[model samples]
Target: MKYRRVKPWLVAGGCLLMSACSLAANLNYRALLVGVSGYPGLDAKLQLEGPRNDVTRMRGVLLQRGVPAQNIAVLADGVPGAELPTRANILGQLDRLASTAKPNDYIVLHMAGHGSQQPVSPGSPFARDEPDGLFEIFLPRDVGAWQNLPGGKGGAVQNAIFDHEIRAAVDRMTATGAFVWGIFDSCHSATLVRSAGGSEEVRMRQVSPQDLGVPATAMDRATPRAPAGTVATAATAVAPSSGAGSVAANRGGSAFFYAAQTSEPTPEMRLPAGHPKRTSHGLFSFVMMQALEGGAGMSYRQLSQYVLTRYGGMNETRVTPLFSGTALDSAVMGQDAATVRQWKLTDAKELTVGAGALADLEEGAVLAILPTPISGLSEAIGYVQVSRAELATARIEPVDYAGIPKKTDTELKVGTVGRLVQQAMKFSLSVGVDLQQCTRPCAFDAPLTRLRNAKPGEGVAGAQVQWVAPGQAADVRLTAIGDRLWLMPPTLGGQQACTLRPMALKAACDDQMERSLVSITLGSLASPGNAAQTIGRALHAASRAANLMRIASALASSPTNGQVKTSVAITSKGGRRTAYVAGQVPRLEDGDKLLVTLENTGRVSVDVTALYLDSRYGITAMFPRGLGASNRLESAASDSFELEIHDDTLGLERLAVIAVEAEKQSERADFSYLAQPSLPSETVTRGGNEADGNALFRDAGFAEYATRGGRPAAVSARTGMQVFSWQVVR
Candidate 1:
């Protein structure tokens, strides 16, 4: 069955799809073929009728493909010895024909014109094949002359259409749901024509009875019938000699077929004059017709093979064909063009949405929408939902998609489709947030302060506290507040610290904790100091909270002076918490010991870091892998190292405290957080030049080697966030 282009209608809420079947939803049988036989100078004028016969032969083949005689349009230009039509006229006709097509429509255009080559500028001799690989199509009338004619309209040859223009045309038409098939018979400079099998030599002994839709014995003069053996193999569709194999050539909907590769050229016949009654078309078309007329029921691939067999035995010129294009709905064109005889079109209407109307849809996610049938459109748009998995597959990252526009609502349109569900489905995703700074007193500290008798019931309040390593460098501040300590960075001053570790400096990290909080008040701190506090009361809450028994015990026994230890635990409140201990001990360290704890109640995952303050000195420690994943710590000033606590090494945890041991010397200890935090690792440049996108860490040979080996690489920001993502497709 032949395919037609049909436009669908839009329904309410962009929910309903157009009812009309997509134009390209069927097989293609109709074609508009044009063959030109004009060559101005390279050779003598062509007989005034060769192109006409060529067009006629094409028409016959199309008829065999199931296209009605009236459906195949032929435009023959410059019949032997006749002047060819103007370029403008030829293009104009083509444009008009193309305009009549709809989405889902398949249009095949064949051109068989004389071609030659010359310099791009004047005064240059005829150039058969230009060095840049461009062969020009010559017009009929140039008599062995390289110069323009007296009429200022010399019959000069021009390269076939430019790729840009062709792509532009294809884009415009295909956007409306049409597939264009362009067949070029003229020789291209890059690819030379080669000999092929001719179907004419396959002698036919008798026409099969099944092949006769009409009487086999009474052959129509216009449609020749071949003998038995020849008839069986007559229309063997062969793949293009350019190595393009054919599939079943026919289907219920749109299809495209060509006779040559975009880079190669097709050959033309050398004809004689005097208006002969019978003339051979170009090798490609002639053989193509044999497959159509033979009624062999051969697949496109089979037809190609048949043509190849004939060409191998024939004395005349032989040429092959190529085919490639989209099929609508469920149309399949296997290797044999003749076998492409059926279409599995389901009357079930397929309404589709266009990307244009999908502007309101949420980007970077799968938007599952229920399709509703509209009067004008085949499908309907009813409801839409978003899925993150779909976004990842489509490469729709948060950075790539546009921010949600400030609109009340918008409908996404789905174009024509064969089924209800489509990869292009659209959905709406609304985003909103509530921000809270750590500067404010956390609820947990309120309980601890009350238990410690520090001003009734107030939340955790403190000067500010930040994690730090004893000897390593870092910038962080910590203040005492009631019975609980809190972070006091000016940017987000006075927020309660949830864990003993510092936050992984990232904007997304902040957002993840907007609704989360960490606090230590009285029993909430869960440490030995929480045992019904006395005297100084809430004064030492910051230190007590940091000294959680489990962490304090583990750190004291660690062995390596430079190795840091990190661990995660779940709090009674259902929040996840992290703890850290530095591997180095401080010299002249204060007798005061600072301990802290952190717990996250928010939904997002976070990596913990530490900033230690030693009497105004700052030290930073880092755990690259989130707690539980790895016990390794990538020190601020050292390579990645791991810290583990064995049964015998538990004693090292107590020795980890700088002030704890210093207090044993009977000396007053002092400590204050620093402002500068320790950075995790050395920065690396992707490539030596700006264009190179590969990157690696300092002294990281594996990363560099992988990049040079064409492996994917990503960019890590100073904040430890990935800025750019790379992936190798092949």
Candidate 2:
């Protein structure tokens, strides 16, 4: 056979693959799973009935599929809600497991529990005017809810987690070039029905315990009615006798697969207390176990077909899997030969970690936390915990080698905030392209590769690139430039190959392009071979909680009196992605502490907002010094804006945000925006579509606040009254 000339880049992962090929048995692959039930507060209402079993069974399936016994790690399988683990603790566990992960290794997560939602505002064309939807999962033994949730009076029951939190975790893992997968079996009603550009009809999700035999009185009295046109999305399929249990929301992504449809029920059966078999698992689990035990060598599609064909249309319970793949018409199929072979490792290793075992390691050992020491030249350093056997064989000292550190092409500065805004751009690009070596510039004349092709935002980070047409040639170069890892063709005609058009305000535009979403940028803060859940949670809480004022102020100003007339009134709304509600009570002041109760309504733990008023605005107040929740700076200025945010609660819990004002009266005007306090102007990074203009007002009376930090609080000749505009994520 004639040999075809191939470029070095074309070999792709050739070195890694060759090494793996040398061994008869595939390399080890691992996973860590944690699920909790028996909550004290909502335990009687939103109990976890299915996910625990599903996750437990999944452990067995992975082991049978060839995952090594030592490779899999699990924590808190049967922990109750009151005893659920802390966010930091869970993250610490995942970090330890990540130590063994290698580039291209697959990491999977399976969660089962409860979910919550926020009330929908009026005029939300896409929703039925119900509560804003929030999705979340449980932390084993977690005693309280997130501070941001509703009705979280410091002692309320904690709920589950949502897509944002999970995506944050996935972003951290995939950045290491490791394939990350998550299987969430909680109730997902909080997810918007109209996202992903799908038809509104798709949002008509099935009802869960609400439809079961549980009395209406047993349901949350706070459950808001769906808007006029969309009243059917409630979970209504459960038998009346069935009580409220945990559920998951439906969020799609190229890197994720939902085992059930948006409108279908994920069922769980109560086994006889002393039954010989398992105690409680849902229909999905039942079918999934059968497929794995058979070892039929079936693809995802074939296996799904087997399950559906065998159990479709069965009386009280039925199962469906919503897969994202190339089959278009079939919802399955289309695995490239190469990609299939890469994922085949999962089939070769027998998952050995039991569901009840704790990882022998901790997070500090497995993941490196990226340190922002200087501008652009940022690097990551971390360590992975390992058994003495692996450490000795890997050859390097375990502690030192465990830390994975890399220096990008850019200089990185320490002590800078807004890193999340800077990282979002990186994440966006990472999700749309493959980052392998290329020797030449991609030909402009060649067919363009659209990075936005796959399920645009599945809440997971990673790109899936397939040749649009066979034999398409668009060889390109991927390199590290500044902090940016550039994906472009090699030098073309002695100049950079790709022509990137910068937006107006050149400096701002450059920063925007180079920024990765806070959820995904893991340099300095992450460790290799391990998941970085801690950094992810901290960043997520900061990014989202920081926006509470902007959203709250936007709604507070929309009414005629510029005040929240009721305790909480749903007001302006746009699409399914965001909603604004107004709640006007006694005006808050700087140093005047206020306590607000919230709850985590989603499946994943949520980051909610609690606003405090600062009477003045000043440079110190604008840039108050603080090192997390414990050591925050108090501004004496009369008009500065400030708020405190926390993460850990899963259900009904409470926390407070104290907004301190500048010490001077003149500064008071600088801290207020609308009748309510708006978010700090610098929060969202004022830009073309992402700017929140309403935030430009320092106080209700001022024309506008400065866009970049440290500018005068008052509008200047060079600055307009409004420096930013509100444009929600579409």
Candidate 3:
């Protein structure tokens, strides 16, 4: 095999560490980067601009993180004297890397190019096995060589590399106890393309089976049934070939991060405003690079979430990224002690760490405090609990172990090292909806369903979970239903106590919007495995409570006009009136009259609009509907709007009062690209009837309107709009 090695350079940047320990003494790090930007094939559409740039960018990241100069290898499309990324050359390098790898070593294989699918041969060992009855193939530089090859011919399979071939090599590396990390910045299907920035072209990054000369009969025979919940992409279907068991057996784990879902196309676009370059990059590759630039400790889960957040912010929601393998919770970059950074104590009881939510830090996360310049695998002196967390900083309070001192004997200074010792344990809880609460057609004892966790950066797809109860255990299959995983329980009837348990629940914000709070009784039978039943119950309950608390916090912290107090009044025709104050509203009944009153200070003209989201996730614009009339209330005037609580408005209802300055209303209109006269009519109603509202929410340009905290942005920089939300329990 022919190849060329690129020596890593000492880039001037902060050390990118994954945790608070020194590099492992015995572990070795190696990388194989293949990028094909110039494909000299019959299909001119295969040429891309991102792959070459992606390799350059990733090489820089690895070097900055201190990978040895001699350990990195590269294969680009057009570099003079460099090895070309042909099928043979690429597979040769993969095998070479696997042979060279040893136990406790780290191997990174990054491929950026076109990905396609080919029909499986009839009666073959791999036939009709994958959810999509086609084998996913990566197009090498010589992909066109097999275009005319006859099917059932001996040489046709050699044209492109199949996923099983890649898996086989990965298996070899893992069998040697080496961790194999694969990053594919390509997509395998083009049937569904969601593009941003008004691009007209749908970039699929795939070639159809017909283009590769696969026989129609073979395809027809292998025409795979769209398995009940199978996503459209072959990437998701082919991931399990190198299952978790293979990865777990290796002390060092393996993982794959795909650029897009199987059915969606991954887009390559020029760098956004903040990046220094104007060159294009795969959306996933660009975001992944940014997530790693922090030089702080992060797990695969944390890193994935970080990327998902930034990617969503870009308004590219068509293709959801996919991550599979056994090490979702393992530290990203590598597992060496040197990859972890040391944090410094800020006070006697609290230490300030340079890792927070972005790094997957959560409340109650335990961290080990090690002295600076950790010499070896030294035992931690004491532990700390994360009391407060921000995007990039966390405040930790020292934990007093039975024998360990609360304070370190040596005065802790800034830059002292700390490592995440234990993650806060969480539980997957299953609760039954009260039989009386079911609307109709409800099963006797089905698990209560909440809002699907479909938002970006939330639940994983196809993950397995188990439901356990006294004398009964049923396996649950999870399918991606919309944006979240839908839990499918076995068809068992009758009310029985049960608790849901996954092998692991990656620490993430459970922001599922639900109608009513599902009460979970953590009985003794609800506990599973080694976790204490009481603790499991408490954690599950706390998680649900946290969701409610988050909503309340959003309202309490909303930007307001001075210290004004708002009140709501319920009145009857008999002239009897009951007043309900903001933050203390009583349970509302159907047909109850609602009079919302607020004092408008003389500071600015306040325009108020009432927004409602019902139990079915149907959002409606409740007020200010007529045309040619301003929703604005005069300064220094007390204004009131009358609304009735509709009888059908049952379950959890959310009401948001949006107040914007009348003077900046034009700016708001311009930002949303809607004319001033059409503003009031653009209100969203149930069942997606309001096209304007749907467009506003769907556009990434207006993503800032939705806050990361799961609330609408209370303050708009461009238009000075302030929003306040309240929950109306009916």
Q: Which candidate's TM-score is highest?
A: 3
Best by lDDT: 3
The list of candidate 3 runs beyond 4 A from truth reads 1-25, 79-81, 145-158, 194-204, 213-218, 225-251, 273-277, 335-730
Name the lDDT value of residue 557 in candidate 3: 21
lDDT of 1 by residue, 3-122 (tens): 343333322121123322232325443466666554332323222334456676566445434445555666566444322444554555556655665654655666655432322322
Relative to the unseen true structure, what is the C-alpha lDDT of residue 579 in candidate 2, on a scale of 0 to 100? 22
Whole-model lDDT per candidate: 0.29, 0.28, 0.49
What C-alpha lDDT, on a 0 to 100 scale, does residue 44 get in candidate 1?
32
What root-mean-square deviation over C-alphas does model 2 reach? 25.9
How would you order the candidates by TM-score, starting with the best? 3, 2, 1
At residue 211, what lDDT does model 1 achieve? 19
Backbone collisions counted per model: 129, 171, 15
RMSD values for the candidates in order, in angstroms, are: 34.7, 25.9, 23.4
lDDT of 2 by residue, 1-730 (tens): 0112222112222122111111112223557665554445434444555555556667755653445556556554463331233455566665654444455455666655543332222233423222322122333445443332245321112333323344445544544545545555444442211111011111112223222222232233323342333322222211011112111111111134454433333444432111223255544445545444432233454444344322211211112344332222211111112110110011113211111101111111122223421212144333222111120011111234322443221221221111110000000111112222223342211112322232432211221122222211111222323322332211111112111111122453233222211112223332321122222122222222222222222121111111101112112222112121111011111122221223222232211123232211111122122312211122221122223221111111111222222233222212212222221211111121222334323222221322233221211211101001111111
Off by over 4 Å in 2: 1-28, 45-53, 79-86, 93-101, 119-140, 143-159, 190-255, 259-265, 270-278, 316-320, 325-730
Which candidate, 1 or 2, has the higher TM-score?
2
Ranking by lDDT: 3, 1, 2
